[model samples]
Target chain A: MNGVKSESVREPLILGNPSLGDVSDKIAGIIESPPTKKFWALVTITSIIALQGLCSVAYTVWVGPGVWGVNNPVGWGWAITNFVWWIGIGHAGTLISAILFLFRQKWRTAINRSAEAMTIFAVMCAGLFPLLHTGRQWIAAYWLLPYPNQMQMWTNFRSPLEWDVFAVSTYFTVSLVFWYTGLVPDFATMRNRIKNVLGRNLFSFFSLGWTGSTRNWAHYEMAYLILAGLSTPLVLSVHSIVSFDFAVSVIPGWHTTIFPPYFVAGAIFSGFAMVMTLLIIARWVLNLHDFITLKHLDNMNKIMLATGMMVGYAYAMEFFIAAYSENPYEQYVFLNRAFGDYAWAYWSMVSCNVLVPQIFWFKKLRRSIPAMFVASLLINVGMWFERFVIIATSLHNDFIPGSWDYYSPSWVEVSIYVGTMGIFLTLFLLFAKFVPMLAISEVKGVMPGAQPKHDHH
Target chain B: MEEQTLTQPVKSESAETEASAHMEQPDARATSDPLAVMGDFVDPNEVTDAARAIHAAGYTDFDIYTPYPVHGLEKAMGMKKTILPFFSLGGALFGLGNAIFLQWWTGTLHYPLNIGGKPFFSPWFGMPVMFELTVLLCALTTAVVMFGLLCKLPQWHNPFQKDAGFRRAVDDTFVVVIEAKDQRFTVDSATNLLEKLGASNVRLVNV
Candidate 1:
């Protein structure tokens, strides 16, 4: 807002021998992000499909989870897999918005609006999973609180499921708060720019009467700093709790100390990959190349590379630990996954999530738009495989041999999966069409050599 | 939103001359030198230009204050970069101190309790609060420092109050004031000097 002051009345603020390259029409275009439409078709179709998936999920809740293919040895199946996949996708937004903000990474402003939107919507998708998986659709609220019914039934607080309610809700709330707070100032900018009467009012309502007063700017900056600080630890904890839902179980393969960090790293890795895939398309379609520069894409590639390596490490470490644990049952769980009925899924996971991301080590690949796109798509596929291997391998070889059975998803299961894809794309399409998917004002704040020569603070 | 061409008057201006002259005539008529006799007072703009010349000639005690942050006024007057970090440090230390003290009070001194064989006093668990406190303190301190600056807080009146409407610092006008308190400053000379510095307006404050 201080920047908005007319430079006319006085001479320019910094009468430096500065170049006009950064504040030119090209730079202005980057700041004022345009809309994209390429994904709109995909988003619409996905939304319809996701809505059907929602119906299937809701139907399963109404009738029971029995309508589909999950069974004794493979009780978790694609429902839980999709749950983990969606939750992992949700992780990147928080990391980008929170961690990068703390580091003063200005490039984060380019991707954070879309990323946070991704986080909120992905959480919506993630929350639906556990709700549907429970089967008792009407009784979902009971799980939220530990209360005695008329029959004096007390829900077990000791269960990791209870911890999940707290963790996921907290993560969602904090993320929502963080996302909304960042939007307020931008909303003020929009409010000031709107033309039509109703549109102006709507923008103003959300902007909360921000006047760009120094006092407000002071507090707004403080709150943002605090939220970023709060979100850093939060990003680590939320997925760790999700991982605990498996690791805390008595299941032989699932009971491992490494799940916490492994899950967190994989979440971040997959999240970044998803962010990359969307951002690349977003930049191209929206014509936001200036805001979302090669620099941003390159930085994301580095994270993907780092996280991909970490995810691969977790996989290897899990294999090594299972082999050395001296427990036949745990070792068999690992072996069964490699040579089991789902071995294709397991190998796909390893190759896509692990090997392909290594391409980013080449700076050319990271900087090249097409190369980054291909690598990002591969990372997502690899992440999905990672979840499939985790869920399928663990559920396949239970303690009883007679109860063992190979799990295959029915057409209904496949359709629901497609529906989720539909839902994700549908929402994403809307984001591209309407939202100012890039942070314009923040980008202006980060121009090199723009601040006073000395520390104004 | 509205495309208004906000072209304010260039250096040589209108009622602006009257506003500056009003602030200086009290100190200006002491000399009827040809330069001073221009109008029973050197027009405030002319003296401000002279002060800027003195500034370019390198004198340190002179300072500029505008109703708003001026673009080139600081360099035009040759002011030193301020020591806001001193206050920022004070704030950071304040936060660090608070976080440490809070943890000490609650964990070590307050009633210590054990839950699940965990120490009630693990300041480590309270690390989030401590971290938040440090940032909170530093941020608040910067505000205090800024207050001690631009507004010179606690006391309501400001030294920059050479003109009643100069309160436009919060909105528009940029002003430069040479203080009566500075050793290098004499009321008569400071006013005359600023008149020549191309100051759109200049004045001496009672400070």
Candidate 2:
């Protein structure tokens, strides 16, 4: 494993062959430096956008869901679609942090901390839609829980929507804990590096006064392993339960049994794309190209291509099932998606999700920075359309012909969605500024020649 | 954990004389007793060798601190496998039970509603909630127990923090500290052992 490096066999996880001290200096240096003008400018813009979203949410609560585009037949509209899209974007973080860790993919060390932060923030954005979508959000929010009320009313445990309340909250809490656990040692690194008394104290408190004792690392590794183990099924289940929100209903487009795997694949597909988009910019902005190498980008593109194909296959199977069942309503729904009122969204989903990723089959396109960046952005748009098509098209022209109507988002709805993007990016930028963008200790652990030469066994 | 001053010289060695000359102003909070004998090593392999030597010499109260978790260093130090998984299991069962009761009591017995005449309490529909709650409780419990009980962390005030050289352990240096509380420890013996094991920058510090 040591003599001569081979590219095909295994590329080095970190480039430039930096020493341990250099790793600390490079990553911690980002936090030590004052925020750049670009960072402040970006934050200001995102904060304004996020504030606009807050106003939209407040106005909706003051008025009602009537402010949005939903009508009788199109009761579930952009709100639900955005909720699923944001939640789907959150999945890639868990996949990179938990699933990849379990698979012993060493490259994850460079990206996991930031990816986990993205997961937490994306879930926050996702949770906002469902909370505010309810007309009387303040009273309706707690109604999802199985708490006793004055009227003796209890939540229906069988409802998929109620199940979503539990799944999403649990995902957020678990992800936060896992992310914090991974950050403790790195916090210690920050504590040691920061010269300011207050900054040092803050990092020290968060670091839990970590001394890096062998005894502590033993238990730390055990806790990390258990978290990764638990999170694997939890991440898969979170999306599966989200899919159940549709599959449990008798709607022709959503009633299929394959929604679970389909949604999970789409979640991972959108999530990796989102991660790629953020990381490509992050590596460039932070001057971390040596750590987050081109190989990492190439590897992520391959995963996106694979999952994109899975999403395409699911789309094909849905259409096949509709025609094969000999059910005219199901057949009409699929046909309507393709050629009816929302064919634009359907085609957009197919072209961006199905066709765009095909470029990754060529290694040059996969490895190219500009090509992958644009592809990541398009995939994000495509994934949003995928959810939009699933929810809007399915609900618009249902069994009753008289109730069908064209649905479009109000300014309020679009503002709210844009606000979520602002919220996500703002929180992410603040996190990137204050926190170590890479998992410092974990990256050091994976560096070539970081460990001892001898095998204990 | 006991603190007592060791004003008497441990040895007539030049290194001790140099370290003592360096300790001109100890922190007001630090005890005058020599808490541990310390060694700094840059290479992880050398630290692993030093840990093995110390453990083989039957000194149980020693620790090696590194910038990252070095492979095989824990085993070389003869540390025991952690029992965190068992606690995780306990938490999972507790959560599973909580979910079952929450669902069964709410759906079947308490204020049950007839939606499509579906069964009030089937494990199949309740599985998602059940699985999520289990993982949630298990993760929280593991974190709490690992930090509070096993690792005993969140100790912002530590003896090692008094020594400036100790800070380097988180960056590039590997630290081997043999506490004075160890059965085989004496300032002279510990310092001699470290130097004999090819440790550099060995020092005796009052923590």
**Could you say which candidate leads in lDDT?**
2
Candidate 2 local lDDT, A1-457, one digit each (tens): 2457766778888988877877888898899988999999999999999999989988999999899988888888999999999999999999999999999998899999999999999999999889887779878845787776787888878789999999999999999999999999999989976866787879989999998888899999999999999999999999999999999999989999999999999999999999999999999899899999988998899999999999999999999999999999999999999999999999999999999999999888988999999999999999999999999899899898988898999999999999999999999999999998999899999988778887554
Clashing pairs in 2: none
Task: Name the lDDT value of residue A436 in candidate 1.
Answer: 44
lDDT of each: 0.64, 0.89
Interface RMSD of the candidates, in order: 10.3, 5.4
Q: In candidate 1 chain A, where is summed lDDT lowest over 10 consecutive residues?
A: A11-20
DockQ leader = 2
The segments of candidate 2 whose C-alpha lies over 4 angstroms from its true place after superposition are A1-9, A455-457, B1-25, B29-31
Residue-level lDDT of model 2, residues B1-207, one tens digit each, is 122112121222454344334434545675678899988887778888898999998999999888788878899899878899999999999999999988888888877889889999999988988999999999999999998889998896877765656666787778899999998999999999999998877888776
Q: How closely does chain A match the true chain A in each prediction, as TM-score?
A: 0.89, 0.97
lDDT of 1 by residue, A1-457 (tens): 2235564553222122222222222322333443335355566567678888877766676678787789888988888888888888999999999898988776787688889889888887778777777777577676665344664433333456765765676677667777766665455455444445675666567655543333334434555665677678777877887897899888887999999999999999989989988888876765666567777888899999998899899999998998898899999999998998889999999999888988888878878888888888888888988888888888887888888888888766777777777777777777555444655445544544333333331
